[model samples]
Target chain A: MTQASSPPAVSIRNVAKSFGKGIYAFRVLDDVSLDIGRREFFTLLGPSGCGKTTLLRLIAGFETADSGAISIEGEDVTARPPFHRPVNTVFQSYALFPHLTVEQNVAFALEEQGMARDAIRKRVGEALEMMRMGSFAKRKPAELSGGQQQRVALARALAPRPRVLLLDEPLSALDLKLRKEMQIELKMLQEEAGITFLFVTHDQEEALTLSDRVAVMQSGRILQMGPPREIYETPTHRFVADFIGDINLLDGEALPGGGVRLEGGTVLSAPHNASGKVTVAIRPERARLAPAGEGALEATVVHSAYLGTAMLHKLDLPGGGTFLLRQSDPTEAAPEAGSRVGLALPAEALRVLDR
Target chain B: MSAALRRFFLLSPALAVILFLIGVPLCLMAWVSLLDKGGTSGVDWSSAPSSANYVRLAWEEDFDGTMILNTSYLVIFLRSVSLAAVTTVLSLAFGLPVALWMASLSRTGRDIMLLLITIPFWTNLLVRNYAWLIILREDGWVSRFVNMISPWPVQLLYNDAAVAIGLTYSLLPFTILPLYTVFEKFDWRLLEAAHDLGATRKRALLRVVLPIATPGIVAGALLVFIPCLGAFVTPALLGGGKTLMLGNIIQMQFGASRNWPFGATLAVVLLAIMLVVMTAMALWRNRRTA
Candidate 1:
């Protein structure tokens, strides 16, 4: 939530970055802009090489943008060095100082700020306790496990009470079970700290699970930016819909009469303004299955997978395209493999993406 | 064969070399250091073993057969120690920045610099000392240039300063190489962590880099200090024989004076000092780790 009278926590405008020069130059970020509200959990979601990390680095003052301005809490800090910025980063590798103990590492920034020694001790203890690393105060980072080290890194960054905290795939190193546990801890930590968190990750589930708002990036540009549900359910770009979740995309032609005609001569009455060749995306759970000759579309059931809570059926459409149906009702028996079945496509669920 | 016997057999060649090359000479030196001088053979093996030569280090017997305190050798020992310390400090000062710069270089650039650093090793140490002699001599251009701008005419050679300069120049690479190895493995991201934590560049260097590079610093100091303490050629040439170190005094006893027992005594004392320093360093390292 943002108040109109107050400035956003971080505002980035028209930032561009390029590496190298001459014929070998690579543009990593091009005209990227966004605003992170105060105390909001904002995530940059993208595959590798999409410049999400570069944008986070630029915001942290670790990098300089080729053009445009970055302001933190209404202060333009584009010309300042990282040391002058009121931001801290939880590095992907933790990057904990090996020679310093956990307590010393957590107190590093406070000491740099010239705080009183007693104050530093108090803050460091509190920060370590919050991360459940209070007992590891005198231990070196090398002696700690990877998850413990990550907690120490988070404590070190949060100890500074920075205006914004930047996390660069901080959980990508953990195992599946630990990662799930950490995701919940990270959300709770962000709420308790009350600082804007600008997280970067390629994991779609993590982005949706933890972020208040998600900005999906590709090729150095923000393809879509919205709440997780909005981005997931109403992705305006073809890349967003395909990247966000498992969806069935079908090639079709949009008629002037406001309906799409599939390649198999099947017409689905979905209201769209586009005409000529188009692509319609639908999530698997939005469609259902029926007995043969009972529904609008025809398909042959290829296989069925039990997903604990749901059954996923893979079917081959008449025009050679495959379709998916998520059957979550336990009472319904799934169609057998190689059996003819009727598939239902809802007009309200079909999303016509603008390429 | 048993594992222990097999291991002994595998290690026999190295053990035998150590015994012959190091152990035998040490035994011979220890025996010589306890005997008296012979009539002509330089060593009186039949003479009773005594601490006479060892006592000579602190008290030299006068013609009246009374022992008196001797400060001459003490002065020489002290000079050797302080000069070695100065050389080690100077080497660290010049080597650290060079090592840091080398570490920051690209792969090819680092290789080229490493090759350049090792280039001086190809030249003989004697030749290199002579080169320094030419550069520091009274009539040399470097001396002339210094004298021109100096408030008074300063003698650039035949002094402890000249000896220290020569020692540091010779042993600088000892410090740089070890320091470079530590710095080469340095995680530069730690510096970024320091900066992000609001540390200025100088603060980061002192607070983080220096502490992390402590092992290399101590190693470099030892490498320079040990050799500089027993340095003979640098003092002989640069000191011009007037400013004699322990090394020069020991050389005098063995060469012109031909006092074999006393020379052996001086060598033993030097080894004792080396052992003490090494032990102290090892103890300090252990304490830090603990």
Candidate 2:
């Protein structure tokens, strides 16, 4: 990651926006602020109506923020219209000009900038070639497949060489297999272009796979922002931990002796230096199944599911809470349904979430 | 029945209507246009078919019994075409912005505007033309207002300009409705995409919206132009017999001159020109698609 010494590629400060007016007004983005570093692939991850897409649109100048300011590459662009801004966007629908061929679509921005004909031709050719769409340059967008149209959209947005590229769920239209293929291509393209990419997606896995950092949003607020590993392993918010991946949370009380007391009167040794009520969160893969009455917590196995690469065991704790353990070792026998088992919760793997 | 046979059966009713309403009259007109003019019966049923009436469009027999070029009919034809073209251009100029504005309005606002546009159509065409005659007459308020601003008296009625105004006023809705439909279905995100790509509003409109709405614009133009070319009431009422068009000349041939062959020939020629224009447009559209 680049140091904070330089101005970030895009900085959003205290931006708030709402739709409608008066009592019926709905706040879509509330006091959102973030800085995306140069050449970094940053993603806003959230579910629908989480204001992630709204924030991206603000950066692209499609919608102006009701309050606060937005700057691109150290230049204030909050008051400027979309045409005056230096950034481009790959819209979710691709938004390729149906009348123009792929080459012309990629050349549109350069033409608007009054570039020379020869330069525009060269740039359009290079951009299309970079997207592996050189052969289809003469075809209109309707003639191409959805994935090919997506590549053309990317090419068009990148051809202008904007300081930042905002993508609003560009891969949501593609099927699962095509979405995966484009995800890798998108990452490589970001690196090759050497520009900051602000991507918005509701798919958490996509965000984790493509972004250098991910910001989790809910109710128009950024709950947490960090590297994917940090956001996944040490999410400060309970929503983030559950939204990112599958995790088991148990209600417990912190004891003065540096351990947690379960609701069912079971005490397990923990390493956190906190006292009072807390929620202990652990990923299913982080725990293991032990023989009955031999591990940190005793439980009865409810069922086991085969997940091709791993086996998932659901257990009912004595406190009536459920715990899941993921076992990857195929050689070990899985506890059958209704069998009693104990769960080993490693101290380091346990996260103490207060909210 | 098979799908193809079922489709044929389903289409036969429409085909029969077209053949009876459109096809039979066209055949009758063609046959009448090929005959010679009869004294009082309008056509000589026993005369051999000939191209004399068609020739009469461009040539006239002089007192010396020699054919000479006739510029009178040519002038009328040119006037008719030029007026229709002017009406089409004026309708587009006044209708495009209205359609764009309507498209940008809220759903309720758009529906209200659509109702306003069609309200004029509820009135009879002859009554509307008479209203324009009243509005554009010498002492009428519109004409008096124009005269008030001018250094000299400005005549607003009984000219090609007045005919054009009446024609455009009557046909404005034709241009607005189709263009409105196209704009309503337009993907406005394309404009946003253009703006995001650094195009100013005007440039985006010129480069994106207008090109996408080409089909609608052409349809509107045809809707106005085809009818304007053969318009009889507006020219006759507003022109005050000073300016003659193809429709007026054809009307005179059948009503006053009792020359049925020439009247039929004019109608056939008008249909032929419209057919050629429509065919060319279809061909051009197909080529663009290809």
Candidate 3:
């Protein structure tokens, strides 16, 4: 039974998937549920083997859930095959047909639908121009470099005008510089096309840069789901905090108020509701390094790495615990290794997360 | 010695063997083909050099036209190419799905399927043709069983149909093997990519699977067509000796007629045709690589 006239772009509920027989069975997805809004750029970010790709496949109708319902545009598409679904994916390998010219590869799906030659030509031309690949349309996939082929793959996927576009680490095959460029191009393309994009990637930076909202998955479950800044600044769980970006976690006990007491007998205030044995997450940039007796905790600078724009300091606390600090000013004098230093945990920058 | 000279020295043995064996015989064949035949004294070379033998072979003997016609140069060439094409299509139709299924199977299952595909290659080609001969005869088990089922039994032996069938059967493994290799190594994510892009199963197969498998299909087609051109055994046996194929005519000229010149001419023509086909294939392959 459906309650709304217009449904969400993608709706998945209690999906489970397993491979092999009884004794040899391996569960890859477990009770996974998600709802992607229409025309929203959604990302599933996680470590390898976290079932993010499987979840994307389930949404794309390439794989069926063992026990759940999937709906697209309000229709229950649980048994619908991938071809029937209004979805398209860009594979990580680029997957361009070697025998076809770049234009032919893009026009393939349209040709399969028996679209007229004129229309196919026009649409293919438009898509190629959109991807800035107009010049390479006549070339074979083998003739182009890695990044060019990736653009062709993107053009081919976008030419069909599917309701949803699924990208499975489409830029993972590129080198560092090309990958960065493609990330911006991909985000812009998704926005220009106005199609719901369900991108799957293990790269945290990619997820942060491209998604309107990201679902962080681990061990077949979504640990947290929110915008990049929200997920990075105010992670709701320990797993989310650690997976998204670099964070210095301080093991502490929850106080009566919205605060935590560190093992070093230092008290820090937080923004989340918490009680009894809790972990507070603070970004490396949040902590300021100074001479002992001037800051919150007595510590020693173990090592400092100059990273051009910033300097990263590894500090050892008095309680046999170590913390990392990232400072943007490389010109500031950082204490030498083995020198006693102070570690400052600013109340505004610290977040208490439930374990 | 320098690298180039040392390499030349290393290749001298093979070069010597080629010059002594292949090059010398080819040159002799060319000379013999040009010689004038004395009535009972065999070939005469002392006479003034002329295009007489080539001219006589083309106009007087009429063997050239008959041999060319009998070879069904047009039909056999087309038929052989089409046979390879059809076999490639059929093998992909059957083998690709089977290969995809096999690829999806467990390690043990894939090994078992691989063994099944390899089973045909292990047996001798002559034995396979003979086995087919037994199965396709007028009173053979297949015909007999069909007769029992239907009032009239189908006659499948000794015709072009039977030849095609035998050729297709013999070359099935060749087509399937290359296709299997292509399908086995195919990235399944591409199929997923097509589906995510709103392509149906049929479209995916046509667009993604077929185009990507072109290399294997072309390879399989060449494998089947080249051997099928010189197929003496299958056409001779399955075609019931009634068929005047080039192979049979060549055999008659060599064995019964003793016209070594005509037979050599036919052999040279067939080789020329093969060379043309092979050259075209090589060009196409090079273009693909480029």
What local distance difference test score does each model get?
0.93, 0.92, 0.79
Give lDDT tens digits, candidate 3, residues B1-290: 99999999999999999999999987766665565554443445565555554444334435454422232344544554565455445655665567567777778987888788778888988898899999988778897887779866577888777877887787777777787788888888777766665577777787788877878877777777667766777878888885445566556656766655555555665667678887998899888666
Window of ten residues with lowest summed lDDT in model 3 chain A: A1-10
Q: Give the clashing pairs for model 3.
A: A87-B196, A88-B196, A88-B197, A89-B196, A89-B197
Q: Per-prediction TM-score, please?
A: 0.96, 0.95, 0.83
lDDT of 2 by residue, A1-355 (tens): 7557888889999999999999999999999999989999999999999999999988888898999999988999999999999899999999999999999899999999999999999999999999999999899999999999999999999999999999999999999999999999999999999989999999999999999999999999999999999999998877898899889988889888678887788887777777788778899999988889888988898988898889988889887878888998856799889989888989989887774
Cα lDDT tens digits for candidate 2, B166-265: 9999999999999999999999999999999999999999999998999999899999999998999899999999988889988988999998999999
Candidate 1 lDDT at B163 equals 94
DockQ of each: 0.81, 0.88, 0.51
- i-RMS of candidate 2: 0.5
Question: Where does candidate 3 stray beyond 4 Å?
Answer: A1-6, A255-276, A288-296, A305-311, A327-336, B1-8, B17-21, B26-125, B137-139, B156-160, B276-290
Identify the runs in model 1 with alpha carbons over 4 angstroms from their true place: A263-266, A275-277, A293-296, B39-41
Better of 1 and 3 by lDDT: 1
Q: In candidate 3, what are the lDDT values of residues A76-95, reduced to their tens digit?
A: 98998887777777887887
**10 residues in a row with least lDDT, candidate 2 chain B:** B281-290
Q: Which candidate, 2 or 3, would have the higher TM-score against the true structure?
A: 2
Spell out the clash pairs found in candidate 2: none
